[model samples]
Target: MSSSTATTAPPATTPTTITSPSPSSSSQQPKPKTKLKLKIRRAVAPADVAATTALINAAFRADDTTDVYLGAEHERISLATEESVLGSMTATDIAVFVGVVSKAAAVDYEGEELEHKEEEEEEIVGHFWLQKKSDTLAWLALLAVSVKGQGQGWGSQLVAHAEQVARDEWKAQRLEFDVVNTRSTLRRWYEKRGFVPTGRAKPFAYELHPDWEGVLRADLEFLYYGKDL
Candidate 1:
């Protein structure tokens, strides 16, 4: 999710992966299971700036799964930076959220081979950027999860949490955002999360700014979506 539209247009559902040993094997193996526990909180500026930037870039940069929207044609997740993240956090209209997982959960859900601080209590796994539009509406941007943290329902949880905050805390009547018109998979992901197309489209507003160095394709546009909070 992001603010690429000249200060306009802001910015997923998934299956649960919780598993347990088969009934037949439960008695013998103590019921081996894998669970994902995440802690989401408002991001602290300055301290979380760099980690947030790295996580966003790692999750959104041109890659096999994300190329349709962000690949070489769109540069990369280059728009995120310490300065920008910190700015968003400090701005009254914006709120930044970060998702974290404990070391034990990382080992059980992900693998030891993944990069993380096993010695630490928890590690950053994902983040999102939100901008309030009005008393009844808000925009979401920069939604992302670390590469190692994807496919385990983190995205879904992030979206649900965002809506709760928008509704309960901000009193937003609806939560809104946009997706690149060409990214069907991503669109479907949002659709599964209950966001529907508003039959709206607009020129893609982001260009390669000096801070986010990279090449961008021409004539891009976005499709908008909204959900009543």
Candidate 2:
């Protein structure tokens, strides 16, 4: 299959528990279900910035799952504190490139609202903030889902949407992203979606990449996943 097409699938078809249930619900026998939908957009307007930031930050906190991506936090959620939130916003625009469907869109959403949505109604529960590094290469900078919508397959859809964006908008030949080499759980998820390891890694500069940190260590080379579009 072409890499572009391959990228349009979930890193894993089936979902599994990546993190322990929240402490507030620890006493409950089973977790309550959360309704989730994820829709991707090529355009994120300046008006949508704050809400987008909120969603992105919430998603980032939830993404501390299984330490699979080797981000800023370990053994706990990083975005809960103020420092991490500031860090994430600094590294990225948090508004322009990636975000979940805004409440405004979902509340009043109809067939005509988004022409793309009318064609493909994969409601956005999460988003992967992408950046074009070059004409031939693109960066999967951030992948996040809303805190309330964690279990309803938003992660997979966002990943799929990233590839679609690559094909539809960027026309990328290969979609590339970095993940911690030690993060087998997340890596497995990406593998199921068709990403393969390139065995390349270097120290991630937290100062430059504020959303992420040195937790992965410079010694921990990220495995590069490339899908030929």
Candidate 3:
């Protein structure tokens, strides 16, 4: 759950625009809006491992613009896999939740729409890990959302869901997580959500992968953030 490449917080949701047709147009057709339905629930083992792995990898590796500015060797890489996801799910203290999204059927749909039913298949768009560190503490980690779902607020929902579970269900007094030191924007996003710096940090666990020695930033560290329930 902890990694220098992990995205601790999600960026703000991008605003969606619904454009209207010009008043002078003969066929004044407005843009059709598709309503997306999101569902969050505990991830089932085996069934969710592959999808969750893909979601995490896609999200963590989505942005690499900083690599060019820093150096080619400073790129972040995601190493999530079905085996690792399944192994994590085996832990009794860790609970993973997945956010699934599907297109809502149109209210005025007719038989013609049935042909596109395949396109309506629900997709696993986001996921997060909530580990019960102790009776009064919980740790949040591995939060991620698919690139397609990034601007839709699914990530925030996942974090909120984790907080509620940790505070109410687990009766935890506080929640905490680690973010890469260089991710100032992400840290600020968490701060806006009531998390603050704990003035503690740990070296990135590069030993997890030998190849990461040269690929990841040599000075990378994880800065802690916490919130009281």
Candidate 4:
């Protein structure tokens, strides 16, 4: 009797595969409403820089990250940040003019991080920056999505926004980005977004990142990527 009971309990204890609710029934469930509307604001003002930087920095860890961290502080802590990537003026003229006229060369800031100097309509949740690489070429300097807001297509929308600006506003013939060879989630993400490798390299960035925890071991191969603007 005891042996029979043990075998019966074993059979009853086996896990069952439950079927999921039907699509029509699942669709009837209440959907939670959200206040934040997902859209890319056309012009990012100077005031948006600080908030955006914090958002971008959140994508990194303390030890190792990527090329975007080069020539910058080790941590994302803004309290220790020496220079403002985002500017304090709505206009780059006053700030940029100072770079040109003062102790430092303005060209030195050509590839520097972004700074905002003026008020803006919407808070910048994510951003994509583009600069003229050539008369016909525009480089995507940065594309960062707020950590909490990622996986929601904000990054894609931002990329599309940048391409439109490059194509229509800048009238650029080509758009590109330098994925400083690192095995990163971002590297794959960019490829999924329609960018292809250009097989290029630059050796100077590693010296600036001697402490890189991520495998930025060499100045390494920068896989340049492009898509028609």
Clashing pairs in 2: 3-228, 4-229, 37-123, 37-124, 37-125, 38-123, 38-124, 38-125, 39-124
List candidate 2 segments past 4 Å from native.
Answer: 1-37, 63-125, 206-221
Task: Return model 2's CA RMSD, one decimal.
Answer: 10.5
Which prediction has more favorable TM-score, 3 or 4?
3
List candidate 3 stretches off by more than 4 Å: 1-37, 67-76, 103-120
Question: Candidate 3, residues 97-142: lDDT per residue as tens digits?
Answer: 8888653432222313334556675668778778787899998877
Query: How well does candidate 4 score on lDDT at residue 179?
Result: 57
User: TM-score-based ranking, best first?
Assistant: 3, 1, 2, 4
Give the whole-model CA lDDT for all candidates, comma-separated. Answer: 0.63, 0.49, 0.63, 0.43
What is residue 189's positional error in candidate 4, in angstroms? 2.4
Alpha-carbon deviation at 160 in model 1, angstroms: 0.3
lDDT of 1 by residue, 1-229 (tens): 3343343222221101101101111112121245465789999746687888787666555344332333444544454556666667766678889998875566564333444554767677778767778778988777887666555677888888999999999999999877766666677778888999999977645543333334444444677899987
Error of 4 at 210 (Å): 4.8
Model 4, 1-229: lDDT tens per residue?
A: 0012211111111111010101111123222232233555533445455554554454342213334344334443221011233331232221110000111211122334335435423444555445555678876644555443433455666677777777887788888766545534556676787877777644434444345535334444455678875
The positional error of residue 203 in candidate 4, measured at the CA in angstroms, is: 2.7
Task: Score candidate 2 by TM-score against the native.
Answer: 0.57
RMSD of every candidate to native, in Å, equals 9.2, 10.5, 10.2, 22.9
Per-residue lDDT for 164 in model 2? 80
Error of 4 at 199 (Å): 1.9
